[model samples]
Target: GGGSSSGGGGSSSGGGASAPAPGPQQPSRPAPGPAPAPAPAPAPAPSGNAAQVAISFAKAQLGESYILGGAGPNVWDCSGLVMMAYGAAGIDVGSHSVSSQYNTMQARGRLVPFSQRQAGDIIFWNDGSGFYHDAISLGGNTIIAAPKPGDVVKIQGLWGGSDIMPYVGRPG
Candidate 1:
């Protein structure tokens, strides 16, 4: 019944945690003495320290061209640059468009009334219509952002009509 292995019977003599018999087919190249204990799986990347890595990467790409919604080593839009920068830290931001990005952040917490934001958080804006807008927290007063078309990636003052603000996620 078992697939063509060199075992005499499909069944094993003992159930769980029994030592394997040295059969011709089950040939242990290292030869069975004491089987080495299985290695432990690697741990998940820490989402908390992830943002710091992304921020450091972004800082290096300061003068990159500003492409509308472009994520690149070349040109980049606001969200794209932020996403790419964060990506360097081994974090994946699932949204590209402003609203898509906003929804992803919203799934985390609230806006409008404004909440206290930490570094590596997200901010979304609605330009009166339902059109998307966004930015990332740089901590303190400045924010790392691709302000507009023709503008290089730069840190800008976060206020005025720039309604988009922080969606407090781990700064990884």
Candidate 2:
């Protein structure tokens, strides 16, 4: 009688556990219905050659001097270079501020994980305090940037360390 009771107890417990699992799952299914509503907002896909257009524009500025707020035919700052580059491809990144550029891309769902960056993607840098700099990716591990004052826009290796943001803007 004791052996039969032990088997019955185990079966009841198993049944009770499975019953709760299905109960929780039913409630979870309805939650996903509303979750997908925001999906359409990010549906705008990148234009086929937009990345190449942006990258070419940035690369063409290789020898341009860096100016604090220059958006330029000549001088450029970090964000200025990025803004102008995307603008060339018909994408307006809102402002010339690095942080704002990042936010705009994020809000528009045009940001890509840093690990998945592609040519013309804008990479931002955080100098502990906040986002301070940005550059345009040239695919692989390279980027083109205006650098600092007195420096010209040039192609360089992608920066690493804690300063690099986790995502890069894909304005195309």
Candidate 3:
């Protein structure tokens, strides 16, 4: 005999029908448990040392006179300043020509995204055909360079917006 199944109550004998072979038993489920804790967040990547050294070296040259192609101790041109800074950091960035520097960076270094450039990365400006100017990043949107013949090596805000600095290269 079988009766309609009742919740939590065993089948009851009623109209003389054999209770459907007791259906397969289900294992008991544990009572509700607490939710699992979330996973920890990932850590940031380690920035390297050469970049900081390059920035420091560049800053120390501030107030030095600008010359057409000056490269060192007392005077500097745009690309010259950048080259010497990277040299101080122990990276050879090739010669003091803007075009040469651009080629070196493109071949050996990486083209950093315009928004992602950091201190010590080399910045290049294009003069229609190819790169014609460069500077050393001083972080915080500032740079140090020998801007022009009459200007001294100095710290200046990034000028001409992002279009001017079409390329940023990391020398590592």
Our tally of clashes for model 2 stands at 0
Instruction: Sort by lDDT, best first.
Output: 2, 3, 1
* lDDT of predicted model 3: 0.77
Query: Candidate 2 on 89-122: residue-level lDDT in tens?
Result: 8888869899999999888888778888877788
Residue 25, model 3, lDDT: 75
In TM-score terms, candidate 2 sits at 0.72
Per-residue lDDT of 39 in model 3: 50
Local error of candidate 2 at residue 103 (angstroms): 0.7
Model 2 alpha-carbon drift over 4 Å, by segment? 1-47
Query: What TM-score should be assigned to candidate 3?
Result: 0.68
lDDT of each: 0.63, 0.83, 0.77
- Report the lDDT tens digits of candidate 3 across residue range 102-121: 78877764666667778777
Residue pairs with colliding backbones in model 1 are 47-172, 48-172, 49-172, 50-172, 51-171, 51-172, 122-167, 123-165
The best candidate by TM-score is 2
Give every collision pair in model 3: 1-17
Candidate 1 residue runs with Cα over 4 Å from true position: 1-21, 24-47, 108-113, 165-172
